[model samples]
Target: MSGPAIEVDDLHKRYGDLQAVAGVSFTVERGEFFGILGPNGAGKTTTLEMVEGLREPDSGSVRLLGESPWPRNPRLLPRMGVQLQASAFFEKLSAREQLQTFGALYGVPARRVDEMLELVGLSDKASTREDRLSGGQRQRLSIACSLVHDPELVFFDEPTAALDPQARRNLWDVLREVQARGTTVVYTTHYLDEAEILCDRVAIMDAGTVLALDTPAALVRGLQADTRVALPAGLLSASDARALPGVGRVQDGDGELVMSTQEPARLVQALAERDRLDGVSVRTATLEDVFLHLTGREYRA
Candidate 1:
């Protein structure tokens, strides 16, 4: 509470010969909506578990709310909440019943349970059994259970992993509202678009190390990645596209001409001057571009 809500230093975790997390360190400011992004098996879950006190690191240290998370600190338990990537619920329990059960575990009052169910927009389905709820509803119930105690800091691991597009957006709105109320949130996901839209700052991780950490806009801009221009195949020869003002790289693939440029307006003007603007469209670089730049195109586990 006085310093960073979460602090990790020289963290290392090894599973036999496989090093899941290696010498990682970072700080999460109080009340900041932070994101940890990486592909599967990038040690994201391992790192988070260590911070949440769910797993002890082989080496290094973690402090949650200024107290050590290892050895199962009881004081931190009351001040923190976590929603795992996958959660199992008692199928026979109603939405309201489930939250009440979790609330009792933390000595939360019955009023708090009701508040949480309504906060996650599950009020109308409060009586529905867990097994009868939709996937999105179950997810919301998971979130509601995590917050039933009103913990100051919350952690979510891939909270929207398998949700439909509409459900994802709806949950996003719920998260935004949570941030508005001043609770610090740490979220992890491989979804670049979600991190870009939801997090105030993101740490990009790969191979058990953080490759980059900053605001999504700053990270993407720091790469100096070019704005991409796409055109129909044969709209202009590859040579002509490459020769265009401000263009940097030209790639011809699948009957389309794609090129990168720093100056989209200038390139557009030049193409228009040549009467070659048809089928041309420009797109700005995104966090996905930054991720690929840092981690390379190779697939990871």
Candidate 2:
């Protein structure tokens, strides 16, 4: 019903001899879960900073909520929430106190502070000092601080970077709840699976430019990769698998027999005919495949 919440057009930035961000452009619709995925030094953070008005772009334009983000626009500040990679909390402040201080800046009421603590699962750690909290709890506190003002658009830079798997999943639930409340979420992550599960659409960046931009499923579909079907070891020999109607490549994986084929249906039917469907597992084209196809396997600086 309204224009896009964010519109970035041909954004460019450079540092000394390095072109940090070059001609990156994309749009984020209101209430959309948009993810910027890339490896280290892919200019994801630089592009995000330019969009958040923290850095000046050498060229191009960014319209956030229909307003320019550059020059540290005061009018847009209250409407945006930014959670940087490094969390900063007031010295000696407890979790609740940290949120209280942030809420005070936005004139938010006390009840909202309680709600934020509960929302981020920080209610129990409300009295814990920032320095005394665990890495996960501190990360949650940083998120609570950014969201205490109830901004419409939230930006998170690798929010789950160093957390354990369990904590990362817990934060995923919290993020889902945030999006459920109609907040536009724009985040950057190195985890391809996480992006596929969380984002409605994603932009994959490399060498300071967008290499692929689309829904995870759409991008994977475009790759046209052969499906991989894995069967239990000792179920069939390699020669038999290779002789199947649609099987292309057969390989022996750890305790499993993996086969690749374009016509998975025909192969599966052939396996079924032989009564070898006991431990069959199928993996179709995935976001990881699409990411690698675009960004390649080279290490980034």
Backbone clashes, each candidate: 0, 0
TM-score of 1: 0.91
241-300, model 1: which lDDT tens digit per residue? Answer: 888899999999998999898898998899889898788788898999998888888866
- Candidate 1, residue 82: lDDT: 91
Q: Alpha carbon lDDT of residue 275, candidate 1?
A: 90
Candidate 1, residue 212: Cα displacement in angstroms equals: 1.4
RMSD of 1: 2.2
The C-alpha lDDT values of all candidates are 0.90, 0.93
Tens-digit lDDT track of model 2 for 197-266:
9999999998899999999999998999999999989999999999999999999868999999999999
